[model samples]
Target: MAAHFPINHHLRPLYRLLSALAGLYMLVFGVVGFVQTSGAEFFTRDEAEWVLGLRTNPAFSLLSLVAGVVVLGANLIGRNVAHHINQLAGVVLTVVGMFSLAVMQTEANVLAFSMVNVIVTFILAAVTGIASLYDRVGSLTAARAEEAHRHSARVA
Candidate 1:
């Protein structure tokens, strides 16, 4: 079998922890959304009922819960997969945030997205995505250097 790179870098554990925390935040927010809205609507723009400044409804809250579960799961799936998960989330979230910004004023946004939502989402996406990308690249580089050093030592 071909050699596989292990996620042994210092940042791996930190990344996992961050992901878990983010997941927890999402789960909590989702639950709060449900409690506050009383299941009266699937989507709403009533900022008065906003959770953390983002318009939410039953569907949106559910989506948050689902996302939380997935992120938490990713953290437990080992380093390699976790790195990829971060990357994927970064791209997806960034796109979603930008899209939400674009449609924030329109009634088509089912999530009742607003400026606060867009800003926060973008921050999350950028930070997670960039950090993951950096970690992956640095880890791989270090691994490669170590491998080369070992190979040269063995040949010598």
Candidate 2:
């Protein structure tokens, strides 16, 4: 599976940019959500409260804020660290989204997550995961070798 993944991909910069944008969006959404729901209980399941078309509560807003900070911080650090962070974050987000979806209609929906929130979470997870796949850095020779190997594998 690792052999099939790209190394030093030409579009790495674009992927990084998209991931950074996603982080920014998350940060902004979290701040707005936090402010909007400040008066509500931390885990309130109120569907009336919304931020950027997504239901939110204090707990979810705080979690989002932390996630955004971690993602943006990793991007700033760059190198393999960012790659690892993106990969982990993607999986975590997917799991959280799934869990939220499961409890969405029940009293267990502490995050106040709606279907739209889950959708956005999944989208962000995909963006980060794709970025991770191509975010590796290596010497020119290594990259060339990897590309050649990939090309030959495709031809075979």
Pick by TM-score: which candidate is best?
2
- Candidate 2 local Cα displacement, residue 30, angstroms: 1.1
On residues 16-130, what C-alpha lDDT tens digit does candidate 1 reach at each position? 6776677666777778877777746677666326886666777777777777677667766655566777778788889989888888888878787768878878876776675
Model 1 CA deviation exceeding 4 Å by range: 1-7, 46-48, 134-142, 145-156
Clashes of 2: 0
Candidate 1, after superposition: displacement of residue 98 in Å?
Answer: 0.6
Q: Tell me each candidate's RMSD, in Å, in order.
A: 5.9, 2.2
RMSD of 2: 2.2
Query: How many backbone clashes does every candidate have?
Result: 0, 0
**TM-scores of all models?**
0.75, 0.89
Error of 1 at 120 (Å): 1.1
Cα TM-score of candidate 1: 0.75
For model 2 the local lDDT of residue 86 reads 89
Query: What's the lDDT of the predicted structure labeled candidate 2?
Result: 0.84
